[model samples]
Target: MEQLANVKAYLCAVFGAVVGGIVNLMGGWSEDLTTLLLFMGVDFILGLLIAALWKKSNKSDTGALSSYSAWRGLCRKGVSLLVILIAYRLDVTLGVEYIRSAVIFAFIANEGISILENLGIMGVKYPTALKKALDILTSKAENSESVK
Candidate 1:
C-alpha cells in the first residue's frame, strides 16, 4: 500500500512537471506542483461527472449531450478555463504577472476547498488555518486585475 502511494505520488510529479513545462512554453510560471495536481484531479473528476451525467443512452447515440445536465458540466469547465486564460492573457498584455498569479491562486484555493470536502467525506478532519489561508489567497486573486 505504501508503495502504491509512492508510485501515485511519483506519477503526479511527472504529470505536473510535464504540465509545468507546457505552462512555461506558454510563458506561464511553473506553479507549485501541489496546485497543479489539485487542478488536474479536480478537472478530471469534473470531466468524469460530466461524462456520466451526459452519458449517451447507448453506444449508438453519438450526438452532443441532449440533456441540460451535460451542458452544465461543459459550462463549468469552460468557464473555469476561460477565466484562467483571460487572466493570463491580461497579464501578458498589461506587462504584469498579477493575473497569472491570480489564476493560479484561485485554482489552488478551489483545489484546496475540494480537498477539504473530500477529506470530510472520508471522515477526516482538516486544519482550519489552511482553509483560511486558501480563502484569503482566492479572494486576493479574484481582484487581481484591479491590483494591476
Candidate 2:
C-alpha cells in the first residue's frame, strides 16, 4: 500500500507539472480564462443532461445521447482552446495584451448561449432580454473576430 501510494503521488506530481506548463504556455490563468472554462464546463454538462435525461439534444436525429456528437463537441472545445493559444501567441508577438482576452470572452459568450439553449431545451424558461443580450454579445464577438 505504501508503494502504491508513492507511485500515485509521483504520477499526480507529473500530471500537475505538465498541466501547469501548458497553462503557462496559454498565457497563464486569468479571470477571463477561468470564466470561459467555467462556462465551457457548464455548457458541456448541460448538453449531456439535455441529451441523456431529457432526450432533447438537437445534435442527434433521435434527440438522445450520441457518442459521436459528444466526441465532436469535445473536439470543438479543444480546437477553441487551440485558437486561444494562437491568440495568446499573437499577443506576445505583437507586444499587446487584448488578443487572448478577446478570444476568451468570445468563447465565453458562445458557451453561455449554448448553456442557455440547453436549458431552453430542458424547458427551463428564461427572460427574453437575457437571450437578446447574449445574442448581441455573440454578434459583437463575431464582428471582432472578423476584424482581425
Candidate 3:
C-alpha cells in the first residue's frame, strides 16, 4: 500500500510539472488566461449539460449527447490553447506584449458566447444586448482570424 501510494504521488508530481511547464510556455497564467480557461470550462460543462440533461445540443443530428461531438470540442479547446502558445511566442519574438492578450481575449469572448448559447438552449434567459455585444466581439475575432 505504501509503495502504491508513493508511485501515485510520483506520477502526480510528474503530471503537475508537465502541465506547469506548458502553462509557463503559454504566457505564464495571467488573469486573462485564467479567465479564458474558466470560460472554456464553463462553456464545456454547459454544452454537456445541454446535451445530456436538456437533450438540446445542436452539435448532433438528434440534438443529444455525442462522444464524437465531445471529442471535437475538446480538440477545438486544445487548438485554442495552442494558438495562444503561438501568440505568446510571437509576442516574445517581437518584444511586444499585446499579441498573447489579444488572442486570449478573443478566445474568452468566443467561449463566453458559447456559454450564453448553451444557456439559451437550456431555456435560460439573458439580456439581448449582452448577446448582441458578444456576437459583435465574436465577429471581430473571426475577422481577425481571417486577416491572419
Instruction: Give the clashing residue pairs of candidate 3, or none.
Output: none
lDDT of 1 at 8: 100
lDDT of 2 at 3: 100
Clashes per prediction? 0, 0, 0
**Regions of candidate 2 where Cα sits further than 4 Å from its true position:** 127-148
Model 1, span 1-148: residue lDDT tens: 9999999999999999987766654456555434655565664464444345544222114522345654564576456655666767777898886666767677777777765664554456778898888788778877874666
Q: RMSDs, each prediction?
A: 9.4, 2.1, 3.0
Lowest lDDT 10-residue stretch of candidate 2? 139-148
Alpha-carbon runs more than 4 Å astray in model 3: 127-148
TM for candidate 1 is 0.52
Backbone clash pairs in model 2 (N, Cα, C under 3 Å; residues 3+ apart or in different chains), count:
0
Query: lDDT of each prediction vs. the true structure?
Result: 0.63, 0.88, 0.88
| Model 3: lDDT to the true structure | 0.88
